[model samples]
Target: MDIIRTISKGTDLGGKDPDHIVELCNEVVQEGHSVLIFCSSRKGCESTARHISKFLKKFSVNPQNDDNEFSSIISALDALRRSPAGLDPILEETLPSGVAYHHAGLTVEEREVVETCYRKGLVRVLTATSTLAAGVNLPARRVIFRQPRIGRDFIDGTRYKQMAGRAGRTGIDSKGESILICRPEEIKRIVGLLNESCPPLNSCLSEDKNGMTHAILEVVAGGIVQTANDIHRYVRCTLLNSTKPFQDVVKSAQDSLRWLCHRKFLEWNEDTKLYSTSPLGRAAFGSSLSPDESLVILLQFFITLIIFEATAFNLVEILLLL
Candidate 1:
């Protein structure tokens, strides 16, 4: 697969021309190839897609006066026809063509619909968050990254290698093109990272196995376990095999359980020999209720309402008034 990596350091599109990116995307789409643009977050992805869509629409309708007119009006019209009807009423009214937004915040059915459209070649461009990078196998002829840095840290040489690796799909494209929009300095760094070989993948299997083992002993000791004991037992019996020193494993597990109890992450009852959820433990287990929510609930339970004027009244003054 052919990979093309571009770098831009400018933080905002206003600093650099957005039309250049949109034009490149149009060119790729006109060649009957799909494109995927990655942004940092859901909001960023949506905003970028919206901006690009507006530019594309303006380009398609007024091609001569317009800067971006690689694709014909007919193609744009076709794209509009294939767009999701569930979009906001205003957006549905003024439908744009050849582009769509995809992210996790969208409903499962909505995501599935976008995937189906993209796979069928009905949708030419997809702008999404990096969530699509790891799991989904969607192959785009061209992949554009608006921002390559992960969070506050500048993407180091190693990170650049991983991001670039997502470019080429094994069998889909003869060569895949990956583009990164960054400043001139960042571009140089990316080039250096690309020249070096990527490091070997780190294995987390050992850590996960140890964690499961610890969880099992914690459950038996009547302490809260992050995951269910049945899951750990299944992993140990079926996947890990009983090859390790059982006594040592048991001792480590017990130690971990005791530590958890001491930390108030879990509570231990010697008499009942059963693990019960503490207030903190319940908050941890219940996905619907967050720690903040639990705190709010507790506060509401203990605190009674007071009149605004009560603060001005001393104990003797309040008693005299009563």
Candidate 2:
């Protein structure tokens, strides 16, 4: 794995810089390999894909109409039009030029269309959000970080490494280049990050309060660990015990149990000397909602029952909120 920084003069880029990106992508794809371009936002990804498709149109007069190897991509796009996402006309035209974009704003089927098109080489250039870097296993010959930021915040070294890891296509490419596209001024910081060693790992259970609370609730609710001692024993048999101190894990588990009890998510079984989940708490375990989040939602449900009459608007609004 190699990390290289590409410093470009005209990179003070606004939305119009997709043209420059498409040119770079063209050079990479010409080598008979795919290019994955990472954009900071969904809008940026769409813009880049448009520029790529437009640029490719200049070189090939009838790229889309040709009997392309990946015929599935055309059918996939047609299927996407039926999806509730209401396919963009630009996207409809761009995929045929062997270029597309993927982002959360696109529905699951729409994103699937882009992924399928790219994987099958129907789409040579794909511009996508950080979701492509982290969520998907799709790799390309060249992975371009158009910017060092994902969304509002600038990415850190750890995230940048994960993105870079997607550069090399395994089995096909012997070596991978992790290219960081940044301004000339930012070169030193980028290089410094590359040179530095990664930091030691820490358990999120000890750090993320919301996650810890939810996990603890699951344990009691699922009957995984009934008591504080059971919680400690469970933690001891896990990988976290290797890095974290034993007593600390037990203490944290105890604290979490107490918090859950206070939240009314867990009931103390005095006779059994154990903790169990209440109905409201068990409901949280079965949901995507965190323990704290579910508690707020549950309390609100009770409050609404007491405070308001089941009027049409109120009922609709409450259901919508859920």
Candidate 3:
């Protein structure tokens, strides 16, 4: 039995009361539940974590040390427990119980530590950037969105939907709760965005002109295609989906494939409707083999040109030349 509570028409508390957020945080902790507080910036994460730590001190936790070298979430928590110093200008205090900050810039190992702490119930609250909504599965009993409105037009609906989605966890809590603190006028849009169903954005191939050109050149360099029909068959069978009829997409794929064929990276057969990679193409693909590698050797061969150009010219110049 999950309940979705919408707090409509409320005062904007963006910078108003640190105590209100801290109090709600303490309430969640007292019930032995974890909470997630989403903030806009890295500095905001540090600031919110600090403010909550002050109110948390009564629960017997010390503040974090400014000089302490904290590389991971576990280390940060440990440092907070060991140090007895006051809060930093940005960070208020350590979680009187347990809490941590999560963001992208931190190393993968550090993010793992934060995730581990939340799952183990060692960290009662996590103040993090919106990135947590996508890749990680760390769920909280309560999710507090500190940002009610994003400025960008394209982000309005999609961004709010993602932040609101974090409210519910399937296994841990029977139900989940999300709180959005905002001015009264903004509530309807927030609620509407949360309730509406929007299709996921379609994935598009990179439009980097130079990268596309290089990809074509690599195919040519490998000596693959001998005829225009071979090039057309390759594009039709491998690159462009037969089901979808987007002329632009088909044209792009055809052009790029033709360039590869002309460069000799692949040899094309009209009758068999097959394009085979050449000797140079095979060696290039296997030159730096790894089980986890993403692109095939031919694609990598094409990418090298873009990389080389990037090194030689500034991005603006490269774009202009491309």
Best by TM-score: 2
* lDDT tens readout by residue for model 3, 83-172: 544222232235333667888755655565557767766677888887787688888888887776432232366666677666666666
At residue 282, what lDDT does model 1 achieve? Answer: 52
Give each model a TM-score: 0.51, 0.68, 0.51
144-202 in candidate 1: lDDT tens per residue? Answer: 87786654556666655555555567777777887777876676776775677767543
- Can you write out model 2's per-residue Cα lDDT over 61-115, one digit (the tens) per residue? 3457455544666687778888887767878878777888888887787777778
Off by over 4 Å in 2: 1-20, 57-70, 169-173, 207-239, 245-287, 309-322
Q: What shift in Å separates residue 141 of candidate 2 from its native position after superposition?
A: 2.1
Q: Give candidate 3 regions above 4 Å deviation.
A: 1-19, 57-96, 150-155, 200-322
lDDT of each: 0.57, 0.75, 0.60
Best candidate according to lDDT:
2
